[model samples]
Each structure stands twice: as C-alpha cells, then as structure tokens.
Target: MKTARAMRGAAARRSGRRGEVLAALWLMAKGYRILGFRLRTPQAEIDLLAIRGRTLAVVEVKRRTDLLTALETVSLDQRERLRRAAAAVAAQRPALAGASVRLDLMALAPGRLPMHIPDAWKGA
Candidate 1:
C-alpha cells in the first residue's frame, strides 16, 4: 500500500501530466505545433516543446487552484534549468537548431482554460 504522501504525489503527477496534455492541445488550437513532451536532457526535463514558424517555445505546465498560483509554481531556478534544457535540446535537434527559443508557462486552474504566458520567464 502506498503512503498518503506518496498517493498524493502520484495524484499530483497525474494532474500535472493532464495539464500538460491540455496545454499542448491549447497551443495547437492557437497554431503551435508540439514537437516534444516530457523531454529529458541531462540538465532537466522539459514539459513541452512547441514550434510556430521559426520560434521554439519551451513550455512548463503547472496545475494549481488559480492562474496566479499556477504561474508562481515556476520558480527562477526552475526557469534557469528549463533554459539550459532548451539549449541542450536545440543543440541536439536539427529542427530546433538556430530557432529562437523562449520560455513559456501554461497555467492550469480547475474549471478554467489553460493560460499560455509567452516569454513567461525572461532568461531565467
């Protein structure tokens, strides 16, 4: 049997994954093509990678009670890690090479649509 904390953590992970899917769909509806999800590099795991034209978006999905809280979950250090991961991915992926990358946050709150904040964290 799993402990209560572990159960909660599992549930949270599920919710986060769901949010990510929702965010990707939302981005698609807004005309962005999702290139990857939960991409792992040595530095960090990017929740989503999207492209529109020559721009690449490194997305972070957060599920919280409200948009503000969800956005707040992406900390500065986390942003830096994401930036590093994006750079690494761009270096390895030919499609993303030389693409302009920006960090974005998709904030998911209950009973509401996901909010896509582009350039959410500027350069970590």
Candidate 2:
C-alpha cells in the first residue's frame, strides 16, 4: 500500500495535470494554439506554451482554494526561470523566435471557470 505522503503526492500530481488540461482548453477557446505542455528545460518547467497572433505566452496553471492564493503560488524566481526556459524553447522554434513573450497565470478553483491573467509577471 502507498504511504500517506505518497498518496498525497500522487493526488497533487493528478490535480496539477487536470489543471493544465483545463488551462490548455481555456487557452484554445481564447484562440491561442498550445505549442507545448510541461516544457522542461534546464532552467525551469513551463506548464504550457501558447501562441496567438504575435504573442507567446508561458502559462502557469494553479489549482487552489482561492484566486489570490492560486496567483501567489508562482514566485518571482519561478517566473524568471520560466522566462529563461521559454526563451530557450523559442530559440529552438522558428515560429516563436520573434514573438512577444510573457508569463501568464491560469488560476482554477472548484466550480469556477479558469481565471486567465495575461502578462501576469513582467520579468525584468
């Protein structure tokens, strides 16, 4: 049998994957094409990479009890890491090379639609 901590970890991973799927569907509804999911580079892991028009969005999905808490889960350091990872991914793809890139947040809670915060973090 799995230990309590292992069970919790599994549940958390399941929830995170669900949130990412929801976020991707939400982005698709907004006309953004999902370029990748769980893009992992040496610098960081981006939940979702999407493009719409001339914009490239590095999306972070959060599942929490509240919007503020969900939004707060992404730290500044994480944002910078995601930005750097995104840059690397963009460099590898001709389509994303010159698009404006930004960090976005998709906050999810029970029974509520995903809240998309565009350009949520303006990395310096």
Candidate 3:
C-alpha cells in the first residue's frame, strides 16, 4: 500500500511538470520570451517567468483533472509567494524592475483547452 501511494504521488508530480512544460510552450507561442522554469528562491519558487516586450510576467501553472480543480489550486498565499519570487528574480535582473511586472495563472486540464489568466491576482 505504501509503495502504491508513493507511485501515485510521483505520477502526479510528473503530470504537473508535464503540464508546466505545456504551459511554457503555450506562452512561447504567444511571443513571450521564456526566462526560467521552476525557478527557486530562498523565499519561494516561481513556476514560469517570461518576458513579452517590456513586460515581465510571472506565471503559475496548475494542472488538474478539470478546470475548476486547477483554478482552485492557486490560493491567495500561493499567489503571494509567486509575487515575491518575481521580485527576487527582478533584483537579479535590474532591467526587469523598471519594466511592467504582471502576475499570471495558467490552468491546464486533461482533454481540455489551456486557460491563461493575466493579472490573476491583485495585492495579495
């Protein structure tokens, strides 16, 4: 039973990573320059960071069996963490600090279309 549970958890993580890759590709197709994937900071981690024109976009990718589930995954605290992580990245790249920074959420569900929500959160 423990082995089964571990396998399931591993599979879920793998699926989530795959969804993130798909989300990254979708953003690239939209002319966004991909900066990093699964970027880790001391404070938090950002799933995807991209640049479009002069705008810096911090993206969170959530994958679930359905759209509703995916949307629910991005909680307030999670959004805040993304925002902070974006700031950390900006500190390293000073040019990004001067540009417009935006927070975005991308939802990917099996057998469904990908949904991109720009400015998904506000002051959280």
**Candidate maximizing lDDT:** 2
Q: How many steric clashes between backbone atoms does each model show?
A: 0, 0, 0
lDDT of 1: 0.88
Worst 10 residues of 2 by lDDT: 115-124
lDDT of 2 by residue, 34-122 (tens): 99999889999889999999999999998888988977788888888998998898999997778988899999999998999999765
Residue 33, candidate 1: alpha-carbon lDDT: 97
Q: Where in model 3 is the C-alpha error above 4 Å? A: none
Error of 3 at 31 (Å): 0.7
lDDT of 1 by residue, 78-119 (tens): 888888999988988887778998999888877887899999
Q: How displaced is residue 52 in candidate 2, in Å?
A: 0.3
Scored by CA lDDT, what does every candidate get? 0.88, 0.90, 0.84
Error of model 3, residue 103, in angstroms: 1.4
Best-to-worst ranking by TM-score: 2, 1, 3
Query: Which of candidates 1 and 3 reaches a greater lDDT?
Result: 1
- 2 or 3, greater by lDDT: 2
